[model samples]
Target: MEEFNINSVQVILWKTMENLIEDDFKKFKNHLKVMKDVPLSKLEKADRDDTVELIVQTYTEEFAGKTVVNILKQMNLNQMANDLQEKVLKIELQPMLEKQKAFEDARRAYEQREEQIKTQAKYAEKQINKGYKKFDQALQDEVAAKIAALREEEEQKSQMMKEKIEKMNREISALSDTMRAIEEKMRSDDVTPPQF
Candidate 1:
């Protein structure tokens, strides 16, 4: 898969064309003319280079190579036919192969991203459920503490009520800070809070 150098392959095809004598070339054309795909008028007027180019245009190098090999073999030029076969890997197939590889790589990356999204969604949902439970418990505790504090305030000194009020103010501030932190974490995770 290094340098394709189509010119090199063309040179090889041209070389085969160069080996053809007048009768051999005529025989070559006769065979090609029979193939419905090969343009009959073009083959008649085509010299060696044009014939090679036309063959390449009509079919791939692989098919052209096969045809050349078969013609040469029929002409009793086995060595030349074998040599052409050796060079006939067909450069046209390489691009299709490369495209296939690129498509596979893209598909794999897409699947990985999809899997990561699923994992993050699961984690975010878990965090939302945890947050809901924590808030429910915190709500119950806050009400219970407030009721307890009210009872104590009625039974206890005025100075003690002032202290409890300050402590309650601090608890409220702490709750606000906790809510902000949770919101920031959800934003970072890019999660929608789960519905009840």
Candidate 2:
């Protein structure tokens, strides 16, 4: 059956238990040794079988001797009571059990999805780090190449400057020699006192 139907049946069962506790408390008064002061209103809120079992045990022979079907019969839920009393005692609870199993399955699926998401996130992080590393290395390589180019250019400029300085020095030395030769010729002409 559908989960909603199971939920509805559970609601009906709880209601029946509530009604039994409210209307038939006096009938089971002798069996109310441990649950005498316990409020019937509390049973209205019972959600688990253990709580119902506590109520049933209070009336059973040894506080441990009753089935859920017997409890339902006592509460006048004859149809559901008989249905549960058949060879399969949990027949009436099949839907609820199936619902519980479905919930467990869904929980496992959710956990797996969460794990998958975490794994994907880790993989994405690794990929990003790898890409960044490659980018960083490429950047470093490009910078190094540019720096080497600049250094080579600077070295060429220094060599060109040195060559220009050497050429200028050679031109200055030649000019000085020419000036000395003119001065020596003038001195020789003055000594000779030549006519025009």
Candidate 3:
């Protein structure tokens, strides 16, 4: 394997770091929309100033130093890694990290709001279904009650019709008996034929 120069290694590491920072910055910016509690217009306006503060708070000196040192060590540049770790204060990289941190905060807040909204929607759906079930049960009960009432009324009407038929039959039987008796009397009293 050809021997690698320290300067070339440093240049490659710097380019890699820059690319990573740029990618993270874009991702952070994209996540700003997810902060539902904070309006997009407000965040856009405040981002210029607020990002600096967020970066200061999130990317502390200790964190930055450790990360740079780790990267250098991974590349086998132990001497350069130690030198960079001492010189790489968080403030020097604050501008690069600011947008990335801000985006993360907004993304987290947005996700939380989304979950809460989902839970509320599910609860509302359950309540609506429960209400519908109650309404359906009440309607079914009402219909059943009406049908039972109609059946009782029909039974009463049928009973009345049967009573009327029985009464008519008795009257007809009595009339027939009277006619037979009258005919018998007429036959018994036949002395002379009456001319009509």
Candidate 4:
């Protein structure tokens, strides 16, 4: 629990009153009247200099009648007003200001988070594209390999068929020559049969 300070309102009142002209004391009193319910401790930090000076000056003056003392009394009343203003400053205004600051901070945090999400999304997209490219290249490589293997197998089969055909042709030509030689020999033997 934070302990609340009670004298800030008085200080504030004094400061506010200090800046005003002497003739404005009556108006200043009206302003103070409006703030009658505000705690003096809250207004401790408030400007009461105006009221203070008015009181001191009025009291010190050699006036025509009891009016002088009465004016001085108004300045005394400022003392009480100041006390409440101080309290309000510490308990109310300060906390309000701090809350405002926190809200601003939260807003900034949200903005930063949004920016980070965007950055992450962009990075993810890049990675996805990169992965797709890699996958596509792998698929292409696989297809090329398969095609090459099929072509190699076809070439091997064609070469084997060609070799087999050439070998068959050579065997057939040798068989034909051998058969003609045998026929020639057999005819020669028959022609010589009467000499035997």
Q: Evaluated with lDDT, which candidate comes out highest? A: 1
lDDT by candidate, in order shown: 0.80, 0.59, 0.57, 0.57
Error of 3 at 18 (Å): 27
- TM-scores for all predictions: 0.49, 0.48, 0.45, 0.43
Per-residue lDDT for 56-92 in model 1, tens only?
7787655666777787787787898888877765454
189 Cα displacement, candidate 4 (Å): 15
Whole-model alpha-carbon lDDT for candidate 2 = 0.59
Candidate 1 Cα errors over 4 Å, as ranges: 1-12, 19-45, 56-65, 78-89, 146-196
Worst 10 residues of 4 by lDDT: 60-69
**Per-residue lDDT of 28-71 in model 2, one digit per residue for the tens?**
33233334543565554544454545554344312222344454
Sorting all predicted structures by lDDT, with the top scorer first, yields 1, 2, 3, 4
Query: Given candidate 1, what's the lDDT at residue 41?
Result: 86
Judging by lDDT, tell me the better candidate of 1 and 2.
1
* C-alpha lDDT (0 to 100) for residue 148 of candidate 4: 98
**Model 3: clashing residue pairs?**
none
Q: What's every prediction's RMSD, in angstroms?
A: 26.3, 11.9, 18.2, 12.5
* Candidate 4 Cα outliers beyond 4 Å, as residue runs: 1-7, 13-94, 165-196
Kindly provide the TM-score of model 3 when superposed on the true structure, using C-alpha atoms. Answer: 0.45
Clashes (backbone N, CA, C under 3 Å), per candidate, total 0, 0, 0, 56
| C-alpha lDDT of candidate 4 relative to the true structure | 0.57
Q: Which candidate, 1 or 2, would have the higher TM-score against the true structure?
A: 1
